[model samples]
Target: MKRSERLVDFTNYLLNHPRKLTTLSFFSERYKAAKSSISEDLVIIKRIFDETEVGTVETFAGVSGGVVFTPAISDKNSQEIASEIAALMGESNRILPGGYIYLSDILGSPKNLDKIGKIIAHEYVGKQIDAIMTIATKGIPIAQAVSSILDVPFVIVRRDPKVTEGATLNVNYMSGSSSKVENMTLSKRSLAPGQRVLIVDDFMKGGGTLNGMKSLVHEFDCLLAGVAVFAEGPFKGERLISDYKSILKIDSIDVEKRSIDVTLGNIYTEEK
Candidate 1:
C-alpha cells in the first residue's frame, strides 16, 4: 500500500484503540509494510496529536512497540463547561431537603447530555477509547452520551449485582460521599486487556466511586484515557488518584439560603 494510505489507516486504528500497542508484525500484517515504515508513520501521527486539543499519543518502544493516545482537555474549556452546569444547578426545583440536589432533569435531558458528551469527546476525538464507562442507573446517560460521540460501546458498572447479558466482574467499594460500603460490577466481556478506556460520570463527591472505577480499570490491565465529570463536590480532598477533570466545584450549599456556590478547579494538569 501507499505510504499515505498506510498512515491514514494507522491513525484511524490508533484512535480506535487508545492504550493498545501495535507491534511491527501487526502493522506488517495489516498494511503489508515494513516495520521501519510503520514506525515512521507512527512518529508523524504522534506529533500531530501533540498539536491538537484532542488527545495524547504515547509511543511505546522496543520489542512491544506501539502507540497509545490519551485525551488532554484544555482548562479553559473545562471551566466554561462547569459554569454552564453550575448555572443549571441553580434551578430552585432541583433543591431538596438537607441540601441534596436532584439531577433527574439533567439526567433526562439528552440534548444537554449530548453537548456535555461532545465537549468531552472532542478532547479524545482521535484517540482510541474502547468503551465509555460509568456506574449504573445514575451514570448510564453520561456514558451513553459520550459513547455516542466516540461511537464506541458504553459499559455500565452496576451498584448492585444483577443478571446481565454478558460476562460479569464484581467489585467492592467504599463510597466516599456517603461513607458506606458499596458494590459495583461490570460485564466481564465488556472490556479487553490493553484497551483504552475513558471514564465519565455525572458528578463526583469525595471521589470514592471514581477511585473504585479506577481500580477496575487497573484490573483489566488497560490504560485509563482520563476521567471527566460535570460537577465536583467540596469533599474531594486529596484523593489517591490524579489527572481528572471536573467542570465545577461546589464550595458550599446553604440549605436554608437555597444557594450553591460554584468555582472551578484542575480540569487541566501537567502530563509527564
Candidate 2:
C-alpha cells in the first residue's frame, strides 16, 4: 500500500484500539512494508496526533515493546467544549419547576457526551482504573463513554433492586434535595474485590449519591481511583465529599428569573 493509504489505516487502527500495544513487526507485516518504512510512517502519524491535540502515540523499544495510543483532549479543546456546554446550560427553557436545570438534551447528545467522556478520561490517564462505576439512568452514558476510551468495564448502581441481578449488595443514602433516606443496590457479581474504581455522575447537588458510591467501593474492598461529575450545582447544605472534580461548575440558579451561571470547572484551573 502507498504510504498515505498506510498512514490512514494505521491511524484508524490505533484509534479503534486505544491503549492496546501493537509491535512494529505486526504493522510492517500487515502493510507488507519494511520495518524502516513502518517506523517512518509512525513518525508521521505521531506528528499528526500531536499537532491535532487529540491524543499521543507512544513508542516503546526492545523486542517485547510496541506502540500504544493514549486518548487525550487538549486544555484548549476541553475549555471550548465546556464553554459551549455552559451556553447550552444557560438556556432559559431548560429550567425545571424547582430550579433544576433540564440537562437531558445535553447528556443525550452523542457529540457532547463523547467529548465530555474524553475530557474526563484525560484527567485519570496516569491512574489505574479497573472499572468505571455510576448510578443508573443519566450517569450510564458518562460511565460508558469513559470506559470506552479507557478500555475498561463499567458497573451501574440501581435505585431499585431487580430480580435479574441475582444477588445484590444494597446501601442506604440520604437524598440531597429531598433530605430523605434512599436505598441503592448493586449486583454482587458486577464488581470484584481489590479493583480500582473511578466513579462518575451526571450532576451533583449535595453529593449524597456520590458519597453512597464511595461507601459501595469500600464495601466491595475496592480503592477509589477518582470521582468526576459532568456538572455540579449549588446546594444549601455542605457537600458530602470535597475531593471530586467537575467539568462544569454551576454557580447559581434562579427559578423565578429562569437563569443559571455555568463556568468551566477545576480541570483547567487545578494544578497538574
Query: TM-score for each prediction?
Result: 0.67, 0.96
Report the number of backbone clashes for model 2. Answer: 0
Off by over 4 Å in 2: none
The C-alpha stretches of model 1 lying farther than 4 A from their native spots are 1-82, 268-272
lDDT, candidate 1, 47-143, per-residue tens: 7876764567776778767666654445565456656776888766676897788888876887778667766776665666888889877878888
Superposed on all Cα atoms, model 1 deviates from the true structure by an RMSD in Å of 6.8
The TM-score obtained by model 1 is 0.67
Model 2: weakest 10-residue lDDT segment is 263-272
All-Cα superposition RMSD per candidate:
6.8, 1.2
Query: How does model 2 fare in lDDT?
Result: 0.91
